[model samples]
Target: MMPAKYYLFTDGSVNPQSKVGFGAFLLISDLAISLPEAKKLVETVSFENTSSSKLELQTLLWVLAKLDAVATEVIVYTDSQNIIGLPGRRIRFEKNNYISKNGKQIANAQLYQEFYKLTDRIQCSFVKIKGHKRSLDKDGIDRFFTLVDRASRNALRNS
Candidate 1:
């Protein structure tokens, strides 16, 4: 039998000092009638060499890992289009297969590989939502993209 579907909203924030924080809210499809009904999750980390894109990718990987252990089918909502588009693009795959002239691995290759592995273990899809936006759902619940965004930033600040 197929497992139930879940929805996850994720966001990541990075400061100028390379401190990174990620936030995600998960809800079983049946309970996702409002933003307040979702559960909040957050974490913080730091990278010596970091970019917002890297933080975003890490955030996706982190949330997916958590979801994989619980749900068989998950639809992830994120603001980072790059994460959503990675699997559909060929350039990154090709780069990961070949080493650069300087003999270094392609940036984010490991994360992409981990993402692929996790995706294989569970049925998952990604949706791109606009960052820092406030909108109302059909059920009149305020969409929590802005909430997740603030949560991530708060995680960074508190860390």
Candidate 2:
């Protein structure tokens, strides 16, 4: 059976001080026709990390874990091309033990491995969006992304 589909907008940032924060909003509808309509959850996590990419992956893991695999058909909207590219790189990463051709361990290898396992357990996909767009120029859906963008960066500042 096809899983119920959901849309998730996510963003993460890392400050110079190595504080990282991730923001994500989950919606039951494909499009956020109204900011409040069918919006399920807004999640934020903050911690000390040097890599925005790692924080991005961790934020995703946190959200999907909260859903507990019930909402498996999630369309993840994010500005991170690395997250968007994870699936395509999976085969190579797995084949090489998440090591680079130079025999060096890849950055965020553990998180990527966990994500690879999660993809096997459930279903999800990625959609890359432009980041840091001016608020006034955004439409219905993008406004929510702006929300996430702020929330994530706010975490960095507040913590």
Instruction: Summarize candidate 2's per-residue lDDT along 85-133 as a digit string, tens digits.
Output: 9999998998998889889999889888888877776578888888867
The number of residue pairs in model 2 that clash at the backbone is 0
Give the true-structure RMSD of model 1: 3.7
For model 2, state the Cα shift of residue 103 in Å.
Answer: 1.2
Q: What is the lDDT of candidate 1?
A: 0.65
lDDT of 2 at 137: 81
Give the true-structure RMSD of model 2.
Answer: 2.8
Return the top candidate by TM-score.
2
Candidate 1, 1-159: lDDT as tens digits: 434687666677777665444544444465445555443433344444557778787777776776777778887777888788877854657654835567786678788788788888878888777664435432222254555666767766776
Can you tell me which runs of candidate 2 are displaced by over 4 Å? 1-3, 27-33, 36-40
- In model 1, the runs with Cα more than 4 Å from the true position are 1-3, 39-49, 90-103, 134-142
